[model samples]
Target: MTAEPNFVLDLTLALGTSAMGGYIAHRLKQPALLGYLLTGLIIGPFGFGLQTDVEQIQALAEVGIAFLLFALGVEFSLTELKRVRAIALQGSVLQIGLTTLLVASVSLLSGSAQTPLQGIFLGLVLSLSSTAVVLKTLTERGETSTVHGQVMLGLLIAQDLALGLMLALLPVLNQPDAVGLALGLALLKILGFLAGAIALGRWVVPRLIQHIAATESSELFLLTVVALCLGVAWVTSKLGLSIAMGAFVAGLMISEIDYADQALGKILPLRDTFACLFFASIGMLIDPTLILNNLSTILELVALIMVGKALVILPIVLGFGYSLNTAVKTSFGLNQIGEFSFVLALGGLEMGLITEQRYTLLLGTIAISLMLTPLWIALAPRVVDGLHRLPMLKDILNRAEEPKLLSVPSDLSDHVIVAGYGRVGEVLVNVLLSRGYSVLVVDNSETAVQRLRNRHVPLVPIPFVYGDADNELVLEKTRLETAKALAITLPDPATTRLVLQRALAKAPHLDIIARSHTNEEIDVLTQLGAREVVQPEFEAALELGSHLLNTLGEPPFDIQAVLTRIRDDRYRTIRPVAQVGEA
Candidate 1:
């Protein structure tokens, strides 16, 4: 008897290829999502043709998209969502509206969009900026706490919230004859879903999670979570909306529960696996011959998508009262078309609102834009600096005023400047104050400053400067030139290097001691002119060794001598030696 093949082998092959591609992309210092896409391209029907069941692969890919949105909803905390509500909601709406109006006009005039529906769909797709790419890049650079980073995050969150609404309205837009009625009906359905979701979230979902969590079986809990996500998604699909919307709502319901973190931890791996497949499926849709024949069009579209969006967003950010540097960085970070655009594009194609050729072009252009996102983010700081040097833009750049978030004594001098109010910073602040030295804290977190103000510590009043330590304006307020030493407690190497470099430039003789997390960072920080670079892990090891020696009745003098030797040798003496194993 002959045996029939199953889809399991197909699934394994897809994941294996994606893993290999992701590894290669990592080695090349690129985003892994790009690798996944390339992998799909290679194995897809249009390429090497390894996978025969394209329909099955695509069906899984849809589930992947749902999980991706679900993960996004879970990570977005209500506190964070509420904090950026004004700018996120209003700024995003304005940005989307303006970008859509302009893009639609351009499409109509160019004859690319034969009907208003196609133009509107085009506008909507282009209006969304990639949240995953921007967030990943910012987190890697450790800029998530910076003003520009916060603004970008807020805007991305707003875009995510608006995604469901956009998905619902897209189908209605396809119906030109009953556009108004369809739109109204869609809105009502969405509203009903929201109301029902809120009620479930408040009354039922939390208790359901509690019961599932009480089982204490990780496997069962995971199964239940998946079921919830899919169940809500199925409900939305029945109501003529996207499964992604339902998944997002399911996530929101769980987010307020105590088990949210555990749920996130359990689901993240699955979400990532599926998300990789989703990107791969997108790559599979690309026809290389089509791209080869329309290379110029692809290049032109990429330019419009990346450059046009950036130019549009820059003014929007600036108008929101952010500085030019912040505005520039935020704009560049969000310039690329988003992952959700793929969903919308797929919807448009299914409805015949766009041709397959146009869909391929969008995929190609979006890929190019996403690939360029990291480079654009890297250039933002330098671009801001260059613009400040130009006589024309200098005035605008200099117009940024210092925020009145903190008060520092005007006569402060010979104090220590602590650049961060995290655990280390707080410790440094207390020690400095106890030793009768005036300390100034430079932290970007407003919440940290508020906590400091409310603290009931016995030490004398500590002056705080609330802003990014890397900003020269903030550094100047710290009286860096007069300060005896600068203690950088910030854990981010990028921020640490920037602050160290800027402080040296401001005052050549300023003594700076910075924290580092890696040997490479230690070297980098030291080269950047930090007087002392302390790696926490090494220090902890040293403390442990000292305690063990004391317990063993080793002479205190001997212990001190060994510790002094290690410190004097810059930890070279205590650094672990590499061992060779017998073959």
Candidate 2:
């Protein structure tokens, strides 16, 4: 008897292997996508050849890309982008243009491209960095809200926005005479699509989502959201643009609606599931033998791409007035070729702009680069610290706009030094100022420092230092020896730890209050000499629990006692710890 096709079995194998891989990656403290990719490499045709339905898996992977971009659109924040608009908008443009010019020039000089158009196509392909990988890595490191993180994300957003134009302009690159017309037409198409999307978001989508919510059937709500996402993607594909771009546009439309959070919550599971297939499919394309044979060449290309891209990006960020630390991290985070480069490479191959061999080489280089991104980012802090330690590099790296200070006493002693000017720092400063405490703020963000300068505190002038508090020089400027206390409220844990260590090294007897993002961090910070470590979430939970007990007629004295015990123990009772052999 003939057997029917087993797409379900194929799906099961793919997802099962992906989950195992992801779990292993998590245990190793690496990005889970690396695990998914390795899984694909093992089971793909070029490896053990366990899966027969590779094409079907790839088709599903397209949905993964759509959902990935869709979720990005939903989470996209205009306010965050606005904060780094100068670098995000202008720096991205400069980066793309410079990278393309440099790559094309090198290709021509090396005789790698037979024609200028081919060289330019190669440049465009290499210019884009992987937004998916970088964003995932940043989120994992808990650096999404930091200055460098915001800058990297802002530049990435600009790149994604430019992707629509790249998709349109790539097809006509061979026809040099028609390049201008193609660009103009592409711009018009993008503008038209955006205008229509804005109109719909402002009028149609909200009403439709509201109506869907009224039904109170979650399945219906999800289906409608998916339909809108894919429907828009389909339209963009028909318009000779990418479905990914269309999906992002659709997400942006939903983001403006009141139900954005609800839509995001409902779609996250599907996005994650499909996104696994997408990353795995990329792994499936790796021909292990090809890489083994061309190992030396691929390694050379990988180093060239990463280092060259970093060189191109570093100055762009610094020239935009960002700190060296910010620039270095941003450069490291975005030096790799993006996944979308694969799409562009395929288009170039179809148009005969590059050979099949060149296409394969580019694919291998991109995959390796993407795999290295997380590890590279993890090492960036060390690189920055090393640079700072060098005598010659120290001055240039720390060179930034002079600190803008407000009214300050000549003898700024017995004052509190706040290490961050973010949400936590702002509140702490206000409280200290209102209570007539002298305050000095240290922050790296120019925008945050400007906000401090613009503060109308009546008679209380907000004196501040505009630099990374983690740096010894910046911390020294805070007058740690004479400060009453140090409040470490930096969002990045590494930076927070560094600031705490440096502060104590300068003033061993200073009362220090530190903020911790995780339970594990509370223990680490406390052990590092922080007099008190506060986990905001745990504090919020304790407050809520106390209210609940009060409403239940429990004595306030007893509630306080219970809270004091938990606090005194550094939250050991509530902190979750992995048991032996848990993994």
Candidate 3:
């Protein structure tokens, strides 16, 4: 019998190893991509030599890249992007230009590149940050809606959008004399593709998707979406453009349709499966012996990338007029080289812009930087605290202009102080005003404060403080001594806890009510001296249960008693219990 192909066996090994690696990374509080990379390293040529069909695996990995960018395009939200358009557009462009310039200068000085074009290529490779890792980290930490989180995401979105142009521009860098001609051709091709995509999105996609949905067959819908994604990617490859770029455009076509959410939902499983292979393939390219031989050099490079990138981003955010705390946090969160940089580096390698050894170094550096991103973000608060303690830095970091007061009486007493103006705070403030209660709002978000200012309304003119509620100076401005109660509704648990502690410190007998974002936060906030803690999800459940009982013809008093009992016991009966030896 003829020897059988090893493709199936290789794929199985790759998937199994990646799954176990991902699980371990999750348990250890790291991004699953880190585990996938480690798995690839182990089973690859440099590791145990388990994978025999590396070429086939890499070909499938290309599909993963296509699907990954496709999903991103489908999930793209114009509304959210609009919220931070200034930073997302102008800020990201500035950041990319500055980072590339700095890296090129350094590469030339160190004699790492033979020519200016090669140096520029090297700079481009390192300029992008990993969106997958940073976003997953932000979601895990419950900071997605925080100011720094929003800013990081906005910058990341812009970077990802810029990748398509970067891919097109890389080829032009390979040509020296025909640079302008090559660039013009690239732009023309991109414009032609975009026009075709827009035309499809505007007319064809909606009708096509609607008809597909009318079939009411899940399998058929999924197959259609997959075909569309692959077909566009194939076309782009034929046009001498990146397949990933075509896939993204295909996704944008789907995004404009009413079935965008359903399409995304159907394609997610396939995207994730293929995306795993892509990350694994990247890992397979890393050589362990090379890394071991140059361990110190790799570590040094990782540090330089993280610190240098952070320093570059810090002032850019500060220049945009965000607070020092926000700027610092955003910088820390995005200091590492991103996953998309691998795509650019691979393109460079293929175009002969960089050598094999240099490609290996870039891969290793990117991996290490991504692995450290989560830990770096976790340390940001502590870094901010240290900065705040330094006498020279304190004033500068804390210098926020006070918000203009609106129609405030000199004798403002026996009123409530609301520490946040988010969804919960907004409603609470409206209710308090409706009930003729004097209210003072304290918020850190410049956008939120600006919105509050623009509400020229039927409601009473509100007084507000434009600074972090956790800061003592901000609390002092809230007239804590004369306030009837304090409501802590900040989305960040750490900030909420700090606000509660600081408010109580200023007025020992203040009746402070705090909001809990997680189950564990309830006990922590109570222990920190909150008079009452409210878990929004739990409260919603209680309301639903009470309504169900009343609908069954039960007495109102009886329903009230049941809810009261649960609340009186601090939700001990309904809260989730920890399993044995659970972390």
TM-score of each: 0.82, 0.92, 0.83
**Candidate 2 positional error at 105, Å:** 1.7
Per-residue CA lDDT of model 1 for 264-317, tens digit only, reads 898888878887787687678766877788889998998887888888899998
- Candidate number achieving the greatest lDDT relative to the actual structure: 2
Better of 1 and 3 by TM-score: 3
Off by over 4 Å in 1: 1-6, 62-75, 115-117, 136-147, 174-215, 225-261, 349-352, 389-396, 401-406, 421-437, 444-462, 489-493, 515-519, 532-583
Query: Which pairs clash in the backbone of model 2?
Result: 130-338
**Candidate 1 local distance difference test against the native:** 0.80
**Candidate number that wins on lDDT, 1 or 3:** 3
RMSD of 1: 4.7
Check candidate 3 and list the clashing pairs. Answer: 129-338, 130-338, 130-339
The collision pairs in model 1 are none
Cα distance off (Å), candidate 2, residue 539: 2.6
* Candidate 3 per-residue C-alpha lDDT over 1-583 given as tens digits, one digit per residue, 9 for 90 to 100: 7545688789989999999999998789677877888899899998999999888999998888778767766865444445677988799988888888998899889988888888888877787887666765775577877778878978986776577667767767756677777667766877797799888878988898899899999999999999999999898877766676678678878776689999999888887788778778878877788888888989999998899999999999988877677888999999999877877889889999889988888888987887788889988977977887799977765555333333345788998999889889999998988798888888877667777887744654577887777766667778899999999988777678778877888899999999988777788888889888999999999999999999999999999999999988778788877611131
The best-first sequence of candidates by TM-score reads: 2, 3, 1
